[model samples]
Each structure stands twice: as structure tokens, then as C-alpha cells.
Target: MVTQRSSRVRLEWGPIGADRIVEPDCLAVVVDVLSFTTALTVAVQVGAEVYPYAWDRQDLGTYAAARDAHHAVGRYEAQRSDSLTSVSLSPRSLAVSSGLKRLVLPSPNGSTISFRLRDSGATVVGVSLRNRAAVAAWLDAALEDDPARVLALVAAGERWDDGSLRPAVEDLWGCGALLAGLRDRGADVLREASPEAHVALAAYDAVADDLEAGLVACDSGQELVRAGFRDDVVDAAQLDVSAVVPVLSGERFVDARRPLGE
Candidate 1:
């Protein structure tokens, strides 16, 4: 659908929208609030570089070894007390670990989307409600430096039982949170936001009072809770808690506390 491109901030629902909107000059912010982006924020906060990898890939060990990074294991595998690997996609697991220099995190949603945009020459940043304000400030500064480039917020939704993309409310809320943060800074950046971004902002406003409760009730949140990951849902709902912004540089995501591309 939205084939015509514009030099403004846009909100894309899932991979399809990402495929349609992402360009060489666009800046892509991947939001996977339920887990991936949240975990990335946590990892980057502790001074770790994260490499986004697709979950379906079997050569992750080789890929991690090539990059001198540690490949993350599944949630169950990472939870074992005797497990040697400290890397995992689970935010709760990563929050407790320290001294990890590099990590290869795999996910079907956010990582897959990040991997798709790797060669597009777009500056991809992993964001969520946790660091929405920081990312918003960073993006606002970026826009001030170069108004010609567009920013696309891609909400990496979950997959359904039939393998169709099921848009998750948590990500929509996360996108809206970032958009709201940008608007709070000044209207100059807000003026560049597309209608879809406004809609997401409106959605966030409707549930801002009880963000954690809302996440706990969402489909993706419920799935995580059923899988014994309610803590992750709670962590993802914390708005503006982190100051770290994970920006994709070279092959891994680094903390962008300083100016981007520096």
C-alpha cells in the first residue's frame, strides 16, 4: 500500500511495512517491547555489544565465532544455574549477568527485522518503552542535524500459530511512547511524524496510565506469562527507565550515549 515515500517519521506495523518503507537513507528503529529490543536495551546498558540474528539460523555459533561474540541460547537453557553461556534473548536473564563484551541474540521478530535492514545502509536502532525517551532525544538531535532523512519505526510483531504476523500491542505502545517523547521535546520533530505515528501515539496515550497492566493483558504478554516470563513483561512496560540507546554500527549494536555515527 503506502508506496509513495516521504521525508518524514513513519510507523510501520511489521516486516511487510519495513520492506516497503525502509530505504538506504532512512533510519529504522526496531521496537520489540515484549523481549528483543527490551533485552537489547538491557544488554547495551551494561556495556555489551549485541548482534541481531534470525532465530531460524543454525549457523549462529559460526556466525558468533566469526564476530568473536557469544551466541545466546534459549530461555530455558539460559536459566540453568550451571549453564556456562551468559547470553540469551531473555531480558530477565541478561539483566543479572555482567562482563559480557559481545552477544549474538536471535529472535523471530525484532532480530529478523534488523537482519533484513542490515545491508540497506539505514541506521537501525533497537528501542522499546524502557529507553523510548533517550531514543527520542537522540532521534530529535539526528533530525536537527539532517532533516532530509526519514525515520521509520518498525514494530516487530509476533507470529501466530499459523505463522502469520500478529501485531502486538506492546510494540505499538512502545512506538507511541517514543513518538510521544519526541513530541514532548518539541513540535519541530513532531511535525515530521506521519499519521501512522500519531495513531500509535494516541494508542499509547489511552493506556499510559496502566502500561504494565496493559502489557500483562496483551496477547504477546499473556503468552510470555504462560511461559513463566511475567517479569519480562513487567520490565518491558517501564517507560523511560533507561538512558542507553542501542544503535547498529558495523555488525553489532553499540551504546549511543554520544552522537550517532561518531
Candidate 2:
């Protein structure tokens, strides 16, 4: 059983931290800047509904098939196979592709956190640097309508060599971007923000001048570059480029800009 806290806005890293921070009244904003959230943002912007699932699950095809969605291949597998690359977690690929109505995006960090929050009775929204501003605006609007509700920003950091949560700079930067956006739109929001939130905002302010350069120099970004996914990192670094916010509804992610029923 998770304990509910009284904070208005908080920041936490990875699933373990998120599990402790999330509560019934809390709204979860999951940030996986390296690729998962970025790809989901791009895919939703292109009218594709995404389903998040654990990367370790080998039955993602079954899960997708049950929902009549297509399961995306891993990044490395997609890179090796030209035909599969389009459905992979590459933001550029998903941004340009069409006819994929539903997709299952598997990730160890973002997807796991999202899945854990699915039944926590909280509204889950997938955010990245690409859609952070828009998401912050949407979140502000939501809070304005219900000022009592709490919000928690979870940065899904990459895993280290020992499978521990490695605090990836890209995720920290992404969290900072969202916090900064919220702070810019609503001063009162920051006044109620937790210390972690303030720290993330400070981090974002520090890298505001050259976000791309900061991402390029990050360890996770360097690893992706060496793995030939440098374009993904570049795409993820484009702050506020997307206006669409991917909100998890039911089992899939849909554009929050639309009406609830529509």
C-alpha cells in the first residue's frame, strides 16, 4: 500500500521513486527523454495511439494483438532490419510514418513506470522535451480547474550496468524543462512545488541556452550515439517542438488536446 503525501508538485527518479511518490489524487507526468516519451509524443502527433509495456516482456505481440495494435521492434532490431526500423522507438521514423493506427511501445524505464501508474487511480501523461511546454500548459489548465489536486513528475532514468537506476542527465533535463514550463506559466505553482521540483527547475535553467549541446554530452546520449541512434538523441533535444501531449487513457495513449470522449 502506498501512502498519500500532501505535496502539490514533486519530482522523483525512475519507477521505485515514482511508486512511492504517486498517490490516488496525484497526476503522474512520466518523462523518458532519450526515446520512449519522445517517440510516443511524435507518434501521437501523427495520429498513432501508443500502448506502453515492459521491455522485458516477450509477449508484447500477444498484448498488442489483443488490442489490435502492432508491436514495435526494439531499436537495435529495427536498426538491423530496414523494414522494421519504421515501427521502432525512433521519433523521426514514427513522425513520418502513416497507417499505423495503434502501436505497442516497450521500454524498460518509461513503459515500466507508466504501467505501474496505470491502476494507481492517477491520470498519467507521457511527456518529453518535445512536448513538455504543451504538457505543462495542459497540466496548468487541469490544476486551475481543480487546484487541490497534486502533480508528480517522474523522470525515468536509464539503467546502469548493474541494472540499478542510473540518473540520466537527459531525463533530469526533461523534468527540468517541464518544471520550468510550469513555473513560467504559473508562479503560484512553483510556490507550492517541492524542493525536488525546484532543483529540477534550476537544472533546466542552467541548460536553457544550449539544450542540444547538454544532451549530446550526457552519458546516455553518448551511448545512443555510439549505438547509431544519434538522430533520436538530436530529435529528443528539440525542446517544445511538439504541441501534442500524450495522455494515457484506458490502455493506450491518446492526444490530450482532443475531447475526452472524442
Candidate 3:
């Protein structure tokens, strides 16, 4: 009889904690709902190339200077992004230049968190609602080599002054839900395990009429609104939207066609 393989699914919430647990051989899924991840989905679909860099502005500047042309994409309140092109920019702009040699991306949380995990031994893949099903399928196939434990890190925003996390509920819900779905291969497992799936499901249930409200209430959902990327939010939130897995290959992220035919 063929032996059955049993894999334990580990669920992690915060960026730091998730980063600490990542191993080189494992698969790393980084989620930053409040825009970065959402924007990434849009950029890729729009045919824009994405180069992720560590949040060090000096390094980013150096990278950009080497490139031909680029644009910055990010939130304003961040620090050290004034000189770069940014969106939702304030104190420092989160920058992503188009066609630039370097993409100086600095999010309050996503970039640093990505760097930490990327530094680890594990294989890193960028996942958001848009590519959730693709990620799951990739994990299933990668596990064939027993590459390593697969880890999903939700780059949820920081905590509130009360020490309670703002946006915690949605991301935590999403991550846990993802774990639940991955653990089982059944069709229902897909919907059962995803927090992103649940949020959308609930919204559909409550306001089958007002999709905008349901997405806005979620932190990551709201970030998409602020960035004027509603189409991306709805698209990413779909299950199995793409048959291919979007992975980090050297500098830019590429869509690796599906490993197995569905």
C-alpha cells in the first residue's frame, strides 16, 4: 500500500513572527492587503514588471539611478520617500517606477517583511486574494519534493494604541482560513480555509447588492479603494482566478504556469 503523507499546517499572523518562523526550504506567502499586494496584482495583470527591493531608500535610489525609467508606488505617511514617485504618499512615498532598473518599494510593512522572509532559506512566493488558488496548487506540487514546510505570512498592518490590532481580524481571518483550505484537498476546503474567501463570502451574503462596502470594511480592501484599484481587489479576491502561480524569480516576479492540469 502507498503510504499516506500527512503535513501539518502552521498558521502565523504578524509580519515579524511569520518572518521568524520561515525556513529556506519552505514556501513563503506574503500578504499585505492594504495596497502593496493588491497593487502588485494590478501591476502584473497590467503587464507592468515588478522588482521588489528592500526598504533601504539609499539602496532603492542606487537601483533606480541605474535603471532607464521608473515610477514609485506607495503610501504617503511612510518615511524617506519624498524624492521618489509615490502614491498615497505623505511623509515618505512607497515607490515603484515603471520600466526602471530598480523598484524602490517601501511599504510601512510589506517590503521589510518580504526582505526578512526572502533572506531565509525558503522559496518565496507573493500571494494575495488574486492568486490564492494558484498559490495553493503550487504548494501542493512543491510539496512533492518535500521541499520544506510551507509557511504563509500575513503582512497585516500594525496594532492600535489599545494594543489591539487594527486590521488584525481580517488578515488573521484570511491566513487561518488559507491554512484550513490547504490542509484538505476537497472542494469545500478551498472556501472553508480562506479568510479572504470568507470575507468575500460574508459580504456577498450580507450585501449581495453593495460589493464596495464589503471590500471597503476590510483593511486590505480599503487600501485598494484608496489606491483607486477597485478592479484589482475584486479580481484578486476570486478563487482560482489564474491557473498559474506568481513567484519571485531573481529580481522580478513571474507567473509560473500551473504545475498540474486542473
Per-candidate count of clashing residue pairs (backbone under 3 Å): 0, 0, 26
- lDDT-best of 2 and 3: 2
Q: TM-score of the candidate numbered 3?
A: 0.64
Evaluate candidate 1 by giving its C-alpha RMSD to the native, one decimal: 2.2
Write the residue-wise lDDT of candidate 1 on 1-262 in tens digits: 5442663888887788898778887779999997899999998888788899888798989999998887788776666648654667788778888778789998989988888788988999999899989998898899889978788889899999898899888889999998889889984867767788888899999999999999999898898899888998898888889999898987789988755444
**111-189, model 3: which lDDT tens digit per residue?**
5566556656667666655556566666767655564344445545545657544554444434533443454444323
The best-first sequence of candidates by lDDT reads 2, 1, 3
lDDT of 1 at 143: 82
TM-score of 2: 0.95
Q: Model 2, 141-175: lDDT tens per residue?
A: 88888878888889899998799999887888888
TM for every model, in the order presented, reads 0.93, 0.95, 0.64
Best by TM-score: 2
lDDT of each: 0.85, 0.86, 0.49
